[model samples]
Target chain A: MGATPTAAVLDAGNLQQLLDILQKQNYQTVGPTVRDNAVVYEHIQSVEDLPRGWTDEQTNGRYRLTHGKGKKFFGYVHGPNSWKKFLYPPARQLYAADRMKHRFDVVAPEPSGIKPALIGVRACELAAIMVQDRVLMDGEYIDPEYKARRQNAVIVAVNCTRAGGTCFCASMNTGPRVQEGYDILLTEVVDSHGHYFTVETASEKGRAIAAQLATSPASEEQLAAARQAVDKAARQMGRTLDLTDLKDSLYRGFDSIHWEKVAGRCLTCGNCTMVCPTCFCVNVEDTTALTGEQAFRIRRWDSCFTVDFSYIHGGSIRATDYSRYRQWLLHKLAYWQDQFGVVGCVGCGRCITWCPVGIDITEEARAVKG
Target chain B: MASKKKPTLAVWKFASCDGCQLSLLDCEDELLAVADVVQIANFPEASRAVKRGPYDISLVEGSITTPHDAERIHKIRRMSKTLVVIGACATAGGIQALRNFTDVRRYVSAVYAHPEYIETLNKSTPIADHVFVDFELRGCPINKYHLIEVINAYLNGRKPNIPSYSVCMECKRKGNVCVMVATGVPCLGPVTQAGCGAICPSFNRGCYSCFGPKETPNTEALAGWLHALDQRPDEIVRAFRGFNAYAEPFRKQSEAYEK
Candidate 1:
């Protein structure tokens, strides 16, 4: 009653019941599932939908699903599909207009009011959702769609028990443990004690859901074991970025010669931007039907890597690949601090893993700031 | 609505398959809507109705593979107010441009019953090589949506919103796992232009680059990754030398790997 202290323990069976409770509460539960040889976020009806006994091996330009040591639900790291797909969406119709006899009547698509209970969200991904909140919801003009979706969402954070090959959240100070921005935080601990999750409710909504689930108060040992697992993952970080004077270094290294070197190998494919959970750049296209009867304005994801993303009247502002690549890197690392109060990158290492050529952002930051 | 005369649109073809021309006919949903805005002036494939040019918008398909086509492309250019070339055949010389690397006489003799009957040029070249093309839509069999976009853009007096970025952008947007990175498959999505909605990658296959070379495609870097993936030099060459083989970036890259 005081603060709902480290509420309860949910074993493997209780975990499945937790999913059922969320579903019964009219929350469309979405979690990680194996698809296309990767662990991706998708709509799940039950706990069976979670990627159990499967993990991933990630490195620069490489991601492969591998067998995990035990039956762990949140075993794998993030895939190409980020949580942004749920909140921001890859493509959305802004509005449409139908030409009448003399005037045009604008029509807005019916708002999808379904509540989403985001389960198994990683610590770094929680940071990404907050980063997007700053960009979209906490801006001069809030995005109505993102605002509605975020408001209706229940975030369930999962503390990492293992580190992926591309993980650097420990250095980013965003993950390996869920510090904040979650309704419910779960730490999966597996050993001779058997597989179980130590649940910590952070909000009233989370506490209400926890009360419905069949659970018992976690012991001091269980709490310590969960902490040790997260601590182990923190120590096993696959990569790291120095945050000391990082923004200042990036600003001073504006004309760094390393840009040219990285650009030589960069494909400008926009994969890094697309896979980044916080990137919110979008391009709008307005099209009038050849019949001149109907018109639509659609907004789709855009990246600075595209030649036309920086286009002006005469030609593209960022004509060369080096300039475009520089724009993306500087925006994510340096300018994002100036714009938003935080660095754009959450250090999930997705950019490194998904890149066809394996362009490491951490390595580039080091090279540029050298 | 009735008084204003609709601008005339023409579809022309030359030295390749009629696949691109079929794309216009395949726009079943938008075909009627398109007809409402533009008069089908001279689409021999769809209609025998031949209105005289200078046409308002000309969607030219295929390449210049004959002495006659080389001269005829110039005539089409002079007649077309806005010449938009619509497929790999019109923009990158198509697969038939493989003849540019070999003897066309051998091909003519191999395919034709009478070699003397075929009057062809030594090189199979894009329409742009022979005429002034206002815009070039690159694809093996053109994406019908892009064809519609090109027509709509021309009619509305705006630049066509065709992206010249790598197909990886589209593939990533579709939320597909990277075939090259994830599965160790050699994909050209990193170098190919965005069109066909990243079809090949979505199907779990590497891009064959039917959309041609993207704007400023870093083929050299892509080739390096392809090589590191254990792709042999010949395989790497073949990867670049697919449907868009004659495109400058693909051509140069393929030539670089050719022994």
Candidate 2:
């Protein structure tokens, strides 16, 4: 995609230069920063703003941040924020209406003019964006807001060297190493010589940014080290979900007693769907002003676990917790394949770690297969 | 339809903190808009101008803790076309339902100057326990947005779009790290319904289950995990016995743990 060679070495000190180049090009740089005791995405102006010397410890129903050995900017695994927040926001006003007597005028929200350079994106997140692209951008009814934001985004994908306690991206075949869907790919390498990043340009825009930065041809040894780092991350996965004939098994196991067992501990809280990078369920709200002269139609994120999500004229379809849990699991693991040509889960483990009850999806999938 | 008429709305209170009813007033931006569409017929908290019943919609807050309130809910149910129970109080008996686990006579004597003056039922129960509830909005104090949606949906002849998901979803969407995981704090977010916008977790505190159990909460599993985390059985029992203590799953769990 670019004229320059695929690989180049960037000094750790010059990481700030890359941020400078993006800012100079009128792109708002969004990267990880320490907030609320966890690393979360936020606007950044310098490399210092990045989550340096901070790493996260994650387990089923738990997540904790810890200090790392050295000044490692990208040492932490994925936090709660996915690129979805920037693209499809939590709450958005579709249009506002103004009424004069019986006549009405509707005004749509203005398009966001700022281009965003997403820094420190992981491989699993890149896959998640692709899934969302299919749902929002490539669908029959394209969401103009999502399309505009996506078009203006520049992806800076980071290859993981360490896996969090709840991560299973390797099992999903969507992460640990970024193979595509990035403007520039970065692998942090710390050697006897010094700390640096082996950066690869995958797009023409990335190449332009690379040319402006202070970089040198990556030595074969540095490239090998970068490759080794990603391989280590793959080996360190916390869990794995087997996808062998998973769709058929999930469909067949609709009445399995296992569902009841899972439901026994499953709080039908839609946490899993909310944290899911690819989950795109939404509900719309219509509001009018007291004067009856103005109104607004707002769209916000919704989950299938809610009875209202399944409610109809008579009553709710999925009345029991067992049925709701079954719907979510089946939709994510099986039905998502039919709809998106891929499983909805990216195996980032936000669902497992953030779940108040610590219900593990991998464990459930395994039990269902059995 | 010959010239549509504005729907008459009533807000009723029983044995509650009146927080849920206050939520309706809390809709500062939309209250004026709401008033334009619906006639506030019988809201004692909002207005002194009392309007008679046979209302189009009745939002019953609180629960039945007294015989008078128990009899009152049924009358209101007959008067209103649509009856929606708002908050943990009206949906699942409120925190006052803790009396259900103990002797109310002894409690009355201990708190009141004259036990004879306190005429009350032994058990505090949800409004639905007394009359057929058209809908139940779950929360300690119901989310104002849900209240608006319920009124709007009823007026438009459509189902209200309220989520039954867990707080974990909102917590993640808010970009809050897991309080249970990060701080080893016990949280009811997994079992609790989504409505409070995961407020506790965003503030770095565990969920207190103010919205009640979601579609199906695995309280047993969570209790087991909490036990493994070294939490006492009494502590676990206390967790479930908060806002919606009388809610079935939580009630059973707390009863099982009670010594």
In the range A1-370, model 1's lDDT, one tens digit per residue, is: 1354655888876798888889988998988999888888899988878899999989999999987666888877788888898888899999999999889999988667868899989999999999999999999978889999999999999999899899898899998888888898888988778889999988888888888877788888998898899999989986999899999998898899888999999999899999999999999988877665788899999999998898889989999888988899889988999999999999899999999999999999999899
TM-score of chain A of each: 0.97, 0.96
The CAPRI quality class of candidate 1 comes to: medium
Q: Give DockQ per model, in order.
A: 0.75, 0.47
Worst 10 residues of 2 chain A by lDDT: A285-294
What lDDT score belongs to each candidate, Candidate 1 first? 0.88, 0.86
Local accuracy of candidate 2 as per-residue lDDT tens digits, A1-370:
2343658899999999999999988998999999877888989999989999999888887788888787889999977677788888888889999886678898998877668899999999999999899988897879988888888889999999999898899888898888787898899988875899999888888888888889898998998888898899999996998877889988888788899898888767676777788989987877754344577888988788877778789998998888888899999999999987889998888888867678899999888777
lDDT (tens digit, per residue) of candidate 1 on B77-157: 898899999899889999988888779899889999999999988888888887778898889898999999888877776
Query: B1-259 in candidate 2: lDDT tens per residue?
Result: 1255788999998988999999999999989878878989999998999899799999999989988887888889999999999999898999999999999999999999989998999999998888998999999989999899888878766657676767776777676777776788889888888889988887878999999987666788888878888899999999999999999999998988887
Give chain B TM-scores in order: 0.96, 0.97
C-alpha RMSD between model 2 and the true structure: 3.4
Best lDDT goes to which candidate? 1
Native A-B contacts reproduced, model 2 = 0.70
Which sections of candidate 1 miss by over 4 Å? A1-4, A100-105, B109-114
Rate residue A283 of model 2 by lDDT.
79
